[model samples]
Target: MFQTSSALIRNVHSQVADRVGTSIVRGDIGVGETLPSEMQICQMMDVSRTVVREAIRTLTGKGLVESRPKSGTRVRPPQQWNQLDPDVLRWRLETSDMDSYLAKLFQLRCAVEPAAAALAAISAGQDDLTLIRTAYEGMAAAKVNEKFVAADIAFHQAIYFATRNEFFWPIAQMFDVTLRQSFTIAARGSHRARALVEHNAVLEAIATRNAEGAREATNVLLKNSADDLVRIRGREFASRPKA
Candidate 1:
């Protein structure tokens, strides 16, 4: 009974946080604006004060809100928010700013992935190479759209881990959400054969311990992806109704 009740409370807490976070991201609740009072929130949400308080804490931890002794809780500015937080990333993607978000995401990838790939080429052990090869094979064999994207993500993750740099792991894992979205967009107009060719180029470079080749291969892949997104975004914007 305790477990069930706890789960119910947690669900409500998450629901409240998600709604409020979405509102903040959408500008319904502007930064520096105080949220409803604890009592008012409890009443409006039809939950206890504890739930509202916990939800507020969750948002605070995500840098969405901050509490002050005299001012209550207020939404924080976008720059203050944790961009890597899963919930915050989801909120940003759900909003109309996905193009800008993707641009930033790709920029980040361009900054880190090529260097990581180069490191992997030099540092990967047999087991690490096996893992990367397995993921590459999965990508090569994936027949369905969803499977292909999942395999693509797995392939990149394997390379990140192969680098054997503890610091690289977390940074690479943080890209999970955005990477899926990116591959989805890329897959719309991308050919499976071309993707396999590019992926193979990177994998072969790493397997051969050619650091420069691995770096250049990853850079080329990212460049192609960015080009595809730019073309797609242009078409999408052109199709939108004039305001």
Candidate 2:
């Protein structure tokens, strides 16, 4: 009973935190603007003061807001945000324009994934190769969008694991949500066929222990994905009604 109640309280606290965090990220609550008073929040949200406080603390830990003795809690600037934090990343994607978000996401992926692929080519063991191959096979066999996206995420995740680099694992995990979003976009129409071929090139290079080949193949894959995204964005822009 005690554990269940505690779990419920935690859920409420997270709900409050997400509501406030989304507002801040969406600029509904502008940066540097103070949040409502604790009593006001408690009354407005119909939750206890403790829940509001805990929620604020959660936001503070995410670098979303800060509270001082006299000054109330205020939203932090974007530069101060922990962008790689999963919750923050989700919020940013929710609020950002699609094109800008895709640009930044691809830039980060371009910098990290190729190097990770090269490392995987050098360091992967039999088990690592098996895991990656299984994920690739999953992608190849997926008949629906949902399954394909999951397999694509698993494929990249396996490569990061194969790198045998502890730091790269967390970086790859941080990208989980963004990867799903991007993979869904890139997999639209006939692009899936081309993507599978590019993915095979990556798998083949890693399987052959060719570090440079893996790097080159990963770069080609990312470039093609970016090009697909641009074309999709162009089509959407063209289809939009004129102001």
Number of colliding residue pairs in model 2: 0
Best by lDDT: 2
Weakest lDDT window of 10 consecutive positions for candidate 1: 1-10
**Once model 2 is optimally superposed onto the true structure by TM-score, how far is the C-alpha of residue 73 displaced, in angstroms?**
1.5
**Residue-wise C-alpha lDDT for candidate 1, range 43-102, written one tens digit per residue:** 776889888899999999999999999989998888999978877877777764666677
Candidate 2 C-alpha error for residue 211, in Å = 0.8
Clashes of 1: 0
Off by over 4 Å in 1: 1-10, 233-243
lDDT per model, in order? 0.82, 0.85
Provide the TM-score for each candidate, comma-separated: 0.87, 0.88
lDDT for model 2, please.
0.85
